[model samples]
Target: MYVSARERKLLERLLADDRDITVGELAEELNVSARTVHRDLQGLESVFRRYGLKLAKRAGVGIRLVGEEENKQALAAELFRLSHHEYTPEERQLMILIALLEANEPVKLVTLAHDLNVTVATVSLDLDKLEQTVEAYGLSLIRKRGYGVELAGSESAKRRLMSDLLFRHVDEHEFLALMKETIQKRADAPLDTVAEKLLGLVDRKKLAIIEQQIEQVKEKLPFTMADSSYIAFVVHLALAMERIKRGEAIHFDPRDLQALQATKEYEIAHELAESLEKVFDVDIPNEEVGYMTMHLMGAKWRNRQGTMMEEPSLTVGMKAQQLIRSVSDKLGVDLSTDRTLYEDLVVHLKPALYRLEHGMGVANPLLDQIKQDYAELFAIVADGARQLFGDIPIPDEEIGYLVLHFAAALMREKKGWRVLVICSSGLGTAKILAMRLKKEIPDIVSLEQASAFEWKGKDVSAYDLVISTVPLPEEYGPHIVVSPMLTEEEARKIREHLERKTSAAKRMEKEPTARRNKPIIDTMKAVRRISETIVHILDGFSLEVVKRRSVHEILTDACRRLERSGVIVDADVVVEELRRRESLGGLGVPGTTLALYHARSFAVLRPSLTMYRLDSPQTVAGMDGEPMEINTVVLLLGPADADEEVLSVLSHVSTLLVKDEQSAATLAYGGEDEVYSLISGHLEQFFDDYWISMKE
Candidate 1:
């Protein structure tokens, strides 16, 4: 099984925890089967054994590597070479400066230029390049006026950059030489003290073993400056470890670490140490702990040897608590809602935290389960953060986890509405109707299947809406309806009835107005004139016109004409919105009608008759199964604020067409006189008791 580079990198990340990882977990992370992971593990084991290491696995447990520290360091170096190519000298120099700037608080541009011996302009350009390069890795370059450039992103991204670029490439012999040089440069007492501290970390046997390995490797290959720098890092790591073991609180000069010219890894390690302390209440001296941890975890590959060791169960309850604390602090939320909630959250976070700590790859099952259980809580968190933070700019992973917590909270609080749908028969047509209704009307709380017989017994009135295959029982009250098919006519009628009922309720709440006679004739004349102007403009174009054009085609043609005439700015944008609306559902009102809305103050109603020759007869789905071949189009235009009035008129016109065949035929072939008469007749009856009587 020859693994690809991506697979190999994934395996390396999995092994970074330097502990046991299950085949199932690996398979889940890689989106593959357990058998495939097992095969990959077997191949890795063979490679390990060939390098004088063993791949050990326990049944019901997972796989891991075991070897001496020095050999592990060597293996880490080799693996680093294989996994990541070294940066060019210029890239390395820029990375070094970036690391320094990030590590220090408020590093000034002038100060950085002075340190790097480069022009300020060059520094600026480098910062710009760095900003662009870091984005893909989920990191950002933060430029604060007067504070200089700093790296901002996740702890994981910081660790990866440090480990891949700085620590892994250092040769053992050169690392030792660098350590000796550092000691020599320091005061004798301090140097001796640091050396002793480092020596104390290893016992006599281990010390001899490490020294011999370093000596042998040096003899085999001469040390380079890069190797020496790495040795200095190792010595610092060992010293830090000894101090940690002794429970000594030690702080070294930032300048000393800075002197090694390994600021990138040093700063990363320092940040990691600080995070560990803040999160876990466990402090390690310097960032050396992070560096040493990486080396130890990736050591087998460093030495080109294989050692099989039972994978350690690195799961730590403390670590989970630390993660929870860190996240809460970052979010500025009181996540500790009592001992039990805190404990449960930590338990939920255990697998992910452990994986993060050890560089092991672990799927976030607990987070997923929490999200599944508490969707509303997640929504609230997102909403709350968005309100407070303005954007709540978190990565998807954090969002996903936070959503889970939010949902759980909401479920506990019972904050949102609960809707139940009652529909006749758990069969095909009812299911389709229910689905369509749900999609069309998002305000409905829930949908459930209930037969007419079942509906009588259920609390039908409690539900938001109910659809039935047969007419509901009288006992079910006015809450029920029969609609086996979710046709456009049925949906529109239901929506319109709801709107009218809502309007009537609002009207009842308002105070009575002084009555006055509305000039119905004048308004009708204005509407007709505006309609005529629109028809004239549309007909003026030479583009091919269809008698019964679909709303989408009409809008597209209208937009093209608008752009050609320079009548609209960003016509393409409006066209896109029109197309999108059409995809949702056709925007056409039933009957031989076209409506145009304008935001300007003037109301333009003009009517003109023009014949559109259709290439082929187009069928429009209209009410009453009336297939309309509308050769004559009646275009209506008005101020955008009059949209409500326009909609009401269109609705009334549709009703008239459905009830009166004469009105439809009159408009289809009516000359100017006939068209005017048809519109006036309908408006008189509609306005008489409605608009005119309301004004009076």
Candidate 2:
């Protein structure tokens, strides 16, 4: 059986972890489909048997490699040796740049073409973009007829560019392993050799020593450096030896040298240089020590527990603010107020500007990858930097780092689904269901339990999904009806059902195609129908005027009051998660003071929603320092594990909160019996209007 490069990766992954891994987990890790994994496993079975291994799979339990460790290790080694021959256009360009930058002598275009397995014309065309990439690193691709091609620039700049190019793909561990293996045996017994080795044919012992020196310097530093900055140090330290052996020299402005020497990073660098001087039996330069200081200046602290920073100097903070403002205005996402994003940007930009001003081309080997991954984000950062710095072209590499700050702010770090379990056999059965669901599915954020009879009248809309032993016919989205001791096939069925429902909800607003007679497929009517099922949860709806106070206090008080009704279990957990959500970003609606405070918790028995009208306008912090004041708040609570139906209603309700806040509030606070009547009546009307608008 022949294996493809991708199949090899699959075998590697299965062999790497001894524990069983679900198809979904494998698909996610390898960035492929579950079906693809299943097919690959079939192809792999025959191949694995030759290695004295078997692909062990159990229903609902995932797959694992069952065999001796030695066989698995040998098989893994063979997988790594296979050449990844196929290359994207971007990959080809990066490969050309790597060969040129690392070449000790001027490498011919023909040689690069042969290495990449491409024609000379294609290789030449790749160099056009490659030149622009290298030019950013303060190096020029100088082609001399017959002599071939060489990178021409300052020796220091060449090393920076080389450092960036060397570790573009792999992390520190992989790079070091390759370095160690290639070094410890370069002159001894050899394996099959590729034309251009990734780790380079450098002195392994020297490379290892440099790596240790860098680790030492990094640990001793006051501030934590960015991953990119650390990579630069490794490459710089390793290449410094190479350049020095070739009798290369470095010089810096005397004043700049004095300034760098005064810093702790420079002092550390000075000691490293002294150690290298003794190891290599050669004098080290002061200019190289200055370069190391610059690397330390751009680092982030490893331990930033509440210690963000005592305010940076006015100019530095202002520069960062200027860039953030530009991004907000142009991109329309105001990240200017995220305390962490702001601080990170300020610290990074100051050192970056210092480097750029001194004509240091900070090589970003990941520039191409970053641009490819976050193209829109990179553009926004570039445009914003353009406005902030005027004509000082900030390298694409620098822009990539800036994008990371905003990217962190934009990242929604959610772990998994908050699940509610409903069982006909009561608490014992419910707990059993929770354990079964958790074992097969690792994505259960929190597992809460309730008897079907107990949960029927409680507010349960707060949970992401509900798992029940038996179906009791609730219109709250979709619920998984599973056996108390779930089977693997049944678990997969549940996952499939949930995925379809989640996909359908996402597609609802997108494909609003009028299927004239099929109102069941129509999202608007689906929402109305689902919303009506929870009407019982909002029974005896009456609005009491809330006095002005913290929204947390108001919500917590409501939870306690509902606890007397035997609707909630743990009020403390629900309230704390709500507060944590608020801290990440305010839930307060803009324009109207309607803050939608909804939480998912095991405490919630069933889906419940109600509105409270405050007597006076309560001011809450809104986005970008805008004071948000609202007289009405709609508090929605669902089962600790909310289902698709509840999620769909929450989606529609979120839309309603933004659009009809005042009207919804007035209708709610108007009359008690009339409130429920008015809401039920309005749903049909809202559905009709929304459907018509969607059609048009």
Candidate 3:
């Protein structure tokens, strides 16, 4: 929320240039150290990433924002609107005319006249206005006498003209309204020009009727002003009327009679009927009954005589009752004949009826209350209890019923649910893991696959659960780790975990102290630890050994280890980024070499050594298209943030490896001790660079 002034300036620069910038250049421009520039880039990248943007870097090319075209357009649009007051309406109109002309061929005066429905003389006058406006904006407006006007000017002039004419004149609300109208008009139109297309969707007949209704209402009420809200109310009522005619439930809000006491009686009735239809699925025809109800309420609100303390009676005659009964029968709901039952039903129906009559709100609150009070009666009348069930089951059952119930409850409580599936490798085994987990979890809205390390670094708070096959990072989410075989015991344990979590969540709601509170990540870590402990007991494999293997090797091993481990499974997990990185550069490094190894069960890493040593070391391209040398090699094991973390470390390592001085110093120390220290120091720097690139 609080962007630094420097970041703000950087954003402006990007917006203006529409290109990526290098850290070196930014440092020079900002008159800051390269380190500071790198930090700033990281901060910026973090902010943008939260908004679904990616900051990409090429080893020597610098940083650029990937997938932010739409964001830039939106920002440009906002800037234009803020500067709109500088242009007059006439100038704006002329500018649009010029743009249209420039887009078309031949510059036909007749076509222009026809487009605006104006005479040729008027078109000429508009062209003159356009020329004057263009000149003021530092642009040249050329008239070909025979051809139409064309803008021939500097790019800056063109940009200024476009910014003022297109972006500046349209505010968000106006834009939304225009877009809605355009889309309504041309439903089949491409999405590029939504606002324009919507205008074409409006039905002429419906629009005329709406206008007529509005006029009539104005005469009766006499106090309502014609504002955008009122216009929207009228449009929605018109649309709702059409929907109701087609037996559709109206979804629009109705005008408030109390707020629009000055509107005419007929308009009030129309608005109220629309509101009622939307709220209660009742289609009341335009009848005297509706008019009378509106008259009563309109009169009360107009006189300011109705108190909040007073409850208005909404009793209808036997004829109206019979009509209601007919509707209920049509809807397949039984209607009680007893006077008291009928009276109570009428009480529930009154608000809707009143709204139908007076352009008042017909919200379902009163009906909901009535249903709660006489649920049994209403249930039978509304139709068999089956109506309540539909596709959803009753709340208390186990299996599918409980799942649906939990899903709905969670949706209501959290607004929605997101999930992440953590698994090793990017190919066969990870996919199988995801598929198996998906079968067990029904409420997952989104599922992303990555290794434990990648999942831990990324934000996981949005996910409800993390189901993994291998030991994950020290922290992740509510985890359910299963073996490759996915035995019956594993299934049972998973179910138990879900049940326990569900029960605990319910208990927490009822009694706050029922369970100790812990951060979600901590809980996930505990779950992982527990799952791993059980796995080790069953399989006799140390979790630490599992963790030490690279993601590539983990996947490769999962496939091969399956035959011996009695885990009959096909682990064909292919690390896409690994291959992609190889395509970009190559994963080989000097002295120590990293190669992607594959087997039957899962993908794994196999680090090997080349016996030959180089006398004069030279740079070789690594997985990031960067130069590297033979001293050290880091094989990116799997698709765990391969593009980000792995590639970043490789880039930094390449930088050090390619340096003759650093390599000589490293070689002098010789053993693993010297190599480890050199690599570790560089790793820290690499991490810093990685963070910086991310921010950028």
Candidate 4:
């Protein structure tokens, strides 16, 4: 049975809340006026009656669903089953827009109305709403009494609109499943949802081929691409291929094309285009390659340490600094010294500005939730962006990404439990989830992020908890599914899950012999591994005065010291890697007179930490992308294939360096014994925690 989205919502609410709910409450919950609620409720009775239930309204008290529990459950089942295609007014309007955009010729309003299961008048009103939206993309909606309705615009604008719709409606998991053809369809499944219709814009067979081609060349790119970005790239190629086949051409400014050709992304794009020509047997244009290059540059996600500031643009860096200052002034927080925030903003805004100027847009599925969850922060960020980037018309999607960078910086913390955050985008939303968990819950020592595509075959046992934005298979173990924004209720659910795990662990402790499937030797080995790593680091740790005057010289001296101490097999190779890492970005910790030079290289034999005090201070770029004076150099190194425990311990030490002013002071000026004691104390506490986990 078919049901209006509103009626279905009202019915679901009534069914969920066994107690009577007033009309005012329902209206408020649904964000509608009481009159609208009454109108929606008018036909809900018939919908409920289909499953043998009744909607009873009292004279003065309120309204309630009166029926057998089984009947109510049956009605709920039906509602859930039909929810996919029961489009709301907004969804219906979106579908109509997609239909018009996808059409080659004018389509009859009756046909659209019939397809949407709405009246012709409703379709007309929807077109009215969509006119402004289309015009925003430099497109116009054409409607005539006899000629029917069609979208009139350049092929480029239409393609952009189509891409925007797909990104907004077809979620990441759904896009992957659709491309892989893994979306199982039931016999009664309806294939007319707004998302499904948007996906229809691309030919599935061609999409799969495009995906395969991208997979082959994706690793050749310099930086990692977020999963959502990967999906967008694939969709763009598929759409471009389809349009090229239809004899439509896309244009790129000749001057802009010249500038893009100098970029590495352009070269990669050109290579991919050549392969497409060979496979698809179509002539590809330089403009298409230029556009693809822009997509690659804009969608880049940094994968390695210190790479965020490579060949940084002075203009974008200053803009990032100014934006941070603006937000700091508005929020009354001193974020100007946050080096990580500054560098992240620089990296994000560099391409972000490009996308906006070129009329490229990305979809943020969590935009609404981000606005709802961080309303005040959103306004502040919006104000900051307006002041820093005047008249750029930055979309909320981009603003949402900015908010995540600031939010993660604000909520940054260090505690003692490991968590893995699996997300679809593996960029903005995932950062929000990780920071929110650290802020709301205690003892999350470290959090690792992976894309939904990367979750397969992961060592789940390494994490204290696995939380995913998308649902995982049952074989992956009990992971809590949550929204990217991580609503308060979802946070509460995660807290409960952790509490239950802790309780069970304690129970196991109480019964020593129960469930002894875990071998004693295995537990002892974990203990030994953690202990050995801690001891090795402490044994090699040293605080000495050095006469090196430059960053390169100081790093050389530090590497030689590590080499002599047998912590690294080769100092020269390690020095070169550290120097290369330094060139990418600043190693100096903000608000401290120390720089952390860290790397994971084959030259390092074990995890080690050492501090070198310079006789005279030297100027170097700070992590915040600003120059700062440093009198101390802190070196942290680990093997390329370090154990999880070893990595965690080294990460803990890194956090301790800038943990606070006192820790920084101690590290910079403290004597050798004092420094060793400080690090050992923290590591000892970490070991104690690790020991407990192993025992459990």
Candidate 5:
């Protein structure tokens, strides 16, 4: 059967593992679509059958390669021989563009198709994508009907495309190692051939000369240089020498060249040009020197000998702080104090801002990986970048690097899950179940016990695992159902569920970012799950669309309605407590247009939620000490002596709103019945994470 390299790797990975793997994970590993992987799996089934292996799948458990260990090994060996690897469309497009650039003459589309082993239509599609990729580097794919195609652009733009495409498919370290191996006569590895494919012909002799010249230039510089800068400088200079030897020249913007000539790096570039002229016997143009200066400006600085090698300009530093603060405000987390995050971002921005200014493309091989693994973090950073960079459009590659700093900081956070125990009998029964689980389950960080009465009265969405003693009408598996006595079978089942639910690490497998995020995702999943399941908590809840113009009237009306429904006895008592709480600080969640008015009240016999959608948003003092609008009011009232567990869940709900008004807005803006589902579904994982903190 026909199989791509990615499919081969997927099969090998599946065979080597004893458990199931998700299609999403395989797609990520192969850098393809999930649908693509699904297609590959279908093709793989017949091939696997050849070696007596079968693909077995179950819902939520993912897909597993089921067979004897010997059969798996045999299948792996067979796949190794049969996997005539096909490049992904992205890889093919990049190679095609490079091949086009290398071709001195217009080549036939059929020839290009044959090279890619694809049809003319596929080649055309690939070229369509290639056009955009090249255009970003200021080069155009010029197609001549009945003739062929050529890349039309300035020598400088073509050179930029060359350098970018060189790094796009491979890592910098790998490319460097390839050159070094060639220099040392150790170029026998398969990777050497792959490097050649990526870089075309490197002319190792020219690279060696530029490597020495760059070393000399580095020693003469005042600032500590980054390795990436040094390596890129060598390649750029080598290629420049090659182009000059061919009597070709590159041009830069006159203003940019004029500005570059004033820098120390350009002074060094001039001296280096003189040395290159002597070695390569070609006069290096001043514009090329400006090009080198541009490249130098984009080099990221590195620490040297335990000292900070460089601080970005004062403006860059201020921009960095502003970005960090913006992200902190968005996530509602104190990211500014993350010293490592701040320092690394400052380092990245020094070069990043310069790259943006110079319109240079920085190829980040990990960009796709970062996008998938740290999606939430990436969104926050990307959103913040817009305000700082304006509509300049920071490349996903640059954004990926920026995300790394925050991702690293988030990785430093403690990882685990929280527990919530629900018992229908009473507090004592709840305690029995909670204590047994706590004693047996070390993963239960903090345990809260509540009777079914209290659980229904409050939002129990803040806990990770909700263990119930009596039969729950709700089917919340991963919501362990066990005896209060902690029977051996029940314990085993709980342990198994906890492992599957909490340790997302096993499924993450190989990527560094995924490995780092396993615990974080696990924690979040727990909270999200609780939020999802808490739809029941909103059962018998009151909803209304109030046209009242006064916040006081809105509060009184909600309390009066809850009292009329017999959910709370004294409308006056609930209203007074809510008013008193509001007097301390506005209950309005800034930016959400939703106000949470909640209080522990003597007049409340049970926990109840009343939501009133205002006809229009009203101005109120924001929790952030600014004037903000509020349109949705959520009134929560609990008995004054409500169980601590009930209070805990209610408090978590408040905290959830305070930390992220956007999340609250998501819950508030949905349809009346849907609000309960949205709120419950979103908070499931938060409860899990709450348990984790308790463990701490």
Candidate 6:
């Protein structure tokens, strides 16, 4: 049976992907029109029939290939064996890159064209496009009429490019399957797939040895290495050994080497190198060990026992705070108190900044999906990263990670559904995945985490849903599989699963004889609490024009007014409390002419937000620690033992201070009625959301 290039590509995607792929998606992926994909499907029907398979198409949903496993394997094997002269543009380009990277000497255009079964002109066009890609890796593609072509760059750049290609093109399942095969068995036969072509770079026996060594060393590391990172590290070491055998060398900066030598990773890398030298019979250079150390340092870590802040750098901590504050201001949400978000960012940014500074890159496999799903949040984080990093060019991968951190923070709440998360380590990526699930699915009331090994025989009956990072055996029963960085599609599937279960449960239940019989007393009480808080603040709310030149004088005068208005018992005590809060961190909202001086004090009589506009702007330290001019001081006060409803209302007021440019301007310069109108409108919306959620 003849399988065309695009057809073969489509079939591979169908078999590899565990989700239904729509015609639009396939069309976009193949760079063809939907009609073209339909036509291709028409031709593929006969091939599927031959393999005892059928194409299942659902309108508005997608297409899926349905068949027995044996039939599917048979078709895959046949396709692998058939060697017809056809290649997609991506395949052809990848072949050319691999050929160039492998070739010690320049390869003629005629040779490349002949191998790819394409015209020299076609190969030249591919090179024209490929040049830009190679350049991004700091490699130059040398082309001449008579001299042929070659890739020129540092050995480190070449290695990185090769690793990137492997990670990008090779399916994770295929890689895992290859790893499962015995070294001797794999070495006996040459695999013919494009993935195998990349895998051929590392010797099978050496790859096994590297994996074994890394497995042994895993326990010694302070933080748990993600499964993906573990695989990448193994590939990295195997490739390094193969390259060393081929007389290729990587150069490390002497200064960088000196710095790395001080690290624990350096000591571990040295030991690993020594062990490899005896087994491979190759002298591992100090430079090679230094590069290995760099990889160790750059690996994503999730500490088990304590927070990532053990011996933290104040600089990175301050940057994390600055980034959080910037994003909070732009997003109009107060996330300053989210300790988990703070820890996650600090942990993520430490290795991330290291990778950025060293010109090393880590692949965020879900970057495109992240950008698609959280476009606005991604933009906010990208902007925040720029403001924090300043001159540093933070890649979208890092920004995608930052978005996950903030996205999780935004989703922080518990309501109804119960979920159990099973992960390999049950600490790092698992925590991230759990947070993402809760963030994406707010119905998740409680989440329980367990390692893969620990969850083998555990009772999961209490959980409403079970989700895992890795695939489980049939005995584990039914569960959804998702990446740590949950994709939109995965979230949709999870929600669908939950909806189906809910529908079934509703069907099984007896019909209610009457509806609306019970009054919503709790919701009524909640509404009353929120309403009273809003009323108290608005009744005492006053926006005054003050002439105080100093912060102390301004605070004293503001507190005296509050005391006289019966909002507080003692003006002196309230001023002291406000000053104490100011000393903890700057009250000035960065990049604005406004300051939010808020405190929860026992001396407070009621929750209130009062605006004091200064006659002359005065400089004060910003929340980000930068000095800024403030022409307005917004004093927000609440009782120390205030209820959740009162605190929620006060928090909403804090958000209004920097909700947006117009809101900030209104708070800083708008007349009392205009500002009060803005606050009332936002508070009304907040109450509506609260009421709706309560009903649900």
For model 3, residues 137-230, the per-residue Cα lDDT tens digits are 5666666777765566543344334433432333224433332343245344442222222322233345545555455545455222212224
- Model 6, residue 89: what's the lDDT? 89
The parts of candidate 5 lying over 4 Å away from their true place are 1-20, 24-59, 63-88, 113-125, 171-173, 182-195, 222-227, 304-312, 335-340, 410-696
150-269 per-residue lDDT for model 4 (tens digits)? 898787888888888887766676787766667534313555556667777777767777777877787888777877778888888989998888777887789989978877799899
Model 6: ten consecutive residues of lowest lDDT: 509-518
TM-score of each candidate structure, all chains considered together: 0.21, 0.45, 0.25, 0.66, 0.51, 0.66
Clashing pairs in 6: none
Off by over 4 Å in 1: 1-102, 132-138, 154-160, 167-173, 179-295, 301-696
Off by over 4 Å in 4: 9-32, 35-88, 113-122, 184-190, 300-309, 312-315, 487-489, 503-696
What does the lDDT come to for candidate 4?
Answer: 0.77
For model 5, residues 558-646, the per-residue Cα lDDT tens digits are 77777787878888988887776665555555546776777777888776666888788788866545788877887766667754345
**Cα lDDT for residue 459, candidate 6:** 65
For candidate 1, lDDT tens digit of each residue in 129-188? 676656755678788777777777654455344433333333222233333343233222
The RMSD of every model to the true structure, in order and in angstroms, is: 29.9, 19.7, 33.3, 8.0, 21.2, 11.6
Question: In model 3, where do residues sit more than 4 Å from their true spots?
Answer: 1-94, 97-103, 109-143, 150-169, 172-580, 585-602, 605-616, 622-631, 639-671, 674-696
Residues forming the 10-long window of minimal summed lDDT in candidate 2: 305-314
Candidate 2 wrong stretches, greater than 4 Å: 1-79, 83-149, 171-173, 176-196, 214-220, 251-255, 299-314, 322-338, 358-383, 395-397, 410-696
Error of 3 at 111 (Å): 6.7
The whole-model C-alpha lDDT of candidate 1 against the native structure comes to: 0.41
Model 4 quality (TM-score) = 0.66
